[model samples]
Target chain A: MVKITYISHAGEARLVEAASGQSAMEAAVHHNIAGIDGDCGGVIACGTCHVHVDGTWTDRLAPPGEKERDMLAYIDNARPNSRLCCQIVLGEELDGLVLHLPIAQH
Target chain B: MDIAVSDIERARSIPLDKIDVSAPDLYLRDAAHPYFARLRNEAPVHYCRESLYGPYWSVTKFNDIVEIDTNHKVFSSDASVGSFVLDDTTLNPVEGGIYLPNFLGMDPPKHDIHRQTVSPIVAPQNLANLEGLIRQRTRGVLDGLPVGVPFNWVDRVSIELTTMMLATLFDFPFDERRKLTRWSDVVTTRPGDGVVDSWEQRNQELYECAAYFQRLWAERAAAAPRPDLISMLAHSPAMRTMSPEEFLGTLALLIVGGNDTTRNSMSGGVLAHHLFPAEWSRVKADRALIPNMVSEIIRWQTPIAHMRRTALADFEFRGQHIRKGDKVVMWYLSGNRDDSVIDRPFDFVADRPRARHHLSFGFGIHRCLGNRLAELQLRILWEEVFERFSAIEVVGTPVRIPSNLVRGYADLPVVVHA
Candidate 1:
């Protein structure tokens, strides 16, 4: 299991242990994390799973793919590190990865 | 039963190339399901050579729809090229079809900006703020419903609640709220569908709608910015410079978008529970399942049947050559029932896992902006319904609206049992 930390917009940090091969979105949703809706079920179709990866851990994760980037373009208030966490598959390498939720998912 | 069997048989007997799912009568009878199911299995990327709206490509499968919707660069929604609906009349003024250009029919950069302008009204914060009032109104509406006597649920509950919400959003006068409903019906319906006598009448009613909103726009513009839609449009930098036609077009979009979709889903919920009484009992036993059940209701209703996009360039998609300027229609109603993605798609499971994952709201940039608001309305309605009525008995068959675009009902006869 890999440990993932999601800090909500209100500064509440939630930690969840996710099985390997599950995306960060699945992990957040499984743990009942409030902010990440994952409404499209990890398809990267809905931008509800948007999160800003911690700058320190950004390079440790695979970069956003073309589809993810295209979706992010339509999200409101998206920043440089904005990525759809559904595209971020959690594994041993991603352990201790931290993601910050947006003020609200558009 | 006989009609359904014949519809299925007819769907199976028709040649693959001859199937045109855009016929309004098919939807009026609610018999388009069989045809769409066949198309999904045989030709997920099927094309019809001829139809009333002209030949178009239909994307029926769930995943294929996601692909087409997300590939906005190639599949353009620009009104200039082609309107969002299969009918070219929405963009062209010929034949009594008014030319109304709004953001839903525009491409990115422009579409993005205009969408962002009105999006905040339905955003999480605004929805959170509106929840209490919505719940209160819902409770009032439900409490007023006649118990143990047949009533038109569509008129009494669905239309009333949604029209009230629309009025609230626009800050229109409460007493005159039904005008919003009238304008919404006028915007979507044709001359013969019963809403209007002719194109001239439709245009006249719409002009009155436009004039009324224009007055509101002026008043809101003169006053300070408020959270209401009119105030927002009047105050927003990007929206304030809209032309008269653009203003009317945007207003029409909001009215129809916010009104019809949720109204049908509201009625659809009762009908779904009537068809699947077991599911209703399960939900009653577990009140927590209301939210998930709301999602299932939206998927089952799929208020807007399809949204059409024009091909920006000649491209090959799913092995089919889609020529530039070709009309591509994404049948959201069909995709919502694709069994591969949704387990037991035909069944209304109140506790269906991953209920939020459905194609009722289109994917990508042009996704239904008021989705959360719609969900909130349904959720609150169901939650409040649980507090009062034990069951909403569907006493008769629903009179469905006859439109290929708006998949909805005109009347739903029901009796509330306390």
Candidate 2:
């Protein structure tokens, strides 16, 4: 199992465990975590699952691709470290990774 | 000028020469697969310099569509961009000078505000409350189907169920619910077609629709705030003061948004079962697949084929020089079939992974508002189908809708064998 922490815009953190192959977005959606809409079901389309990876764990993650990067441009609160959670696949190596959610998922 | 050719015959005989995927007849005959396939393979972002809808760019690949759908800034869906369809309003304005400025046509602040006003109607709480009613209706529609006898599923099942739900959302007169469907059809219908013989008639019908809804608007405005869509629009600060055309536009948007896609999806789901019996059997055996199956159905059918947007500025896209004011069509139908994104894009697979990943409900701020509700309806539908019927067989080929915009069946003959 892979453990991950999702920090809401309000700064409330919720930790959840997901299967190794599942995405962080899928884990949040499955656990009903607040602020992670994942409306497109990890399609890399809707940026509703926008998340800012914690600085410490950012190095372990692969950079966003053209599709994800293009989608991120539409996110109102997108930052250089921001990533769509759906694009981030959880693995044992990145256990306990943290993601900060945007206040609004529009 | 030389001779008249029917769509079906032309579809069968046409060579691979510069295929026009925008041709309405190509879709009318349900023969757009090869055309779109060619586009995806040869030129993902090809430009059609001339067609019935005039010059437009076709973005056929999956990632390309995602780029356009997400970047609403450069690719604007403004009503002036011809209301998200190939019908170029710049070339020929809609008759009666009627342009409804719904949020789908607006950008940023205006779009967000307007969308928020009606968002609560489909909020999680409301959908939870609506689940029981939807299930009851689904049970009624399925249980009432004629067993072992051919019937029009499009009308008996799809239209009946979606129209009922639309009425519930709008709180329109229950007895006069069919009027909603008629108004929706009229709004999407093109001129010179059988739906409306002339543009004048279409405008007249829409005017009547406006007058009827105007009464409802006044009633809702007078009464205390309610949960119905009309009331939401009537009472909300952002929507309350809409111009007549804008009011009509919002109403049209709401009505069609609630009607066509869901209606077509219901029919399309049944047709999917008929087309793929093995997959249907797997889904029938394992109810867990219903949720994913619903997404696959929507993707396979792509009820609304393509949504048009206009280029706000000259830009480079996928190594192509797209000029300002070019009509760009994101062919959701073709994109859904993009093998790069979806595996075995042609076949209907019930257990397909990440099935909810589809372009049918669209993307970004303008993505479908009623998506969850549409899924709930379909989920309950298959649940009831499992309990009631053993087989819902297709009796005849579906009569396809003759428009490039709304890709759906007008008549789908089917029978349930218990």
Writing each residue's lDDT as its tens digit, candidate 1 over B298-393 gives: 998889999999999998989999999999999999999999898889888888888888888898888999998999999999988888878889
Best-fitting candidate, measured by DockQ? 1
Whole-model lDDT per candidate: 0.90, 0.83
Residue B224 lDDT in candidate 2: 99
Segments of candidate 1 deviating more than 4 angstroms: A19-21, A58-66, A76-80, B1-3
Candidate 2 lDDT over B168-210, as tens digits, reads 9999999999999998888777775457877678778888999
- The residue-level lDDT of candidate 1 at B399 comes to 89
What DockQ results do all the predictions give, each relative to the true complex?
0.58, 0.24
Q: Which stretches of candidate 2 lie over 4 Å from their true place?
A: A5-23, A26-44, A47-106, B1-17, B89-92, B95-97
Name the lDDT value of residue B27 in candidate 2.
73
Worst 10 residues of 1 chain B by lDDT: B1-10
The i-RMS of candidate 1 is 2.0
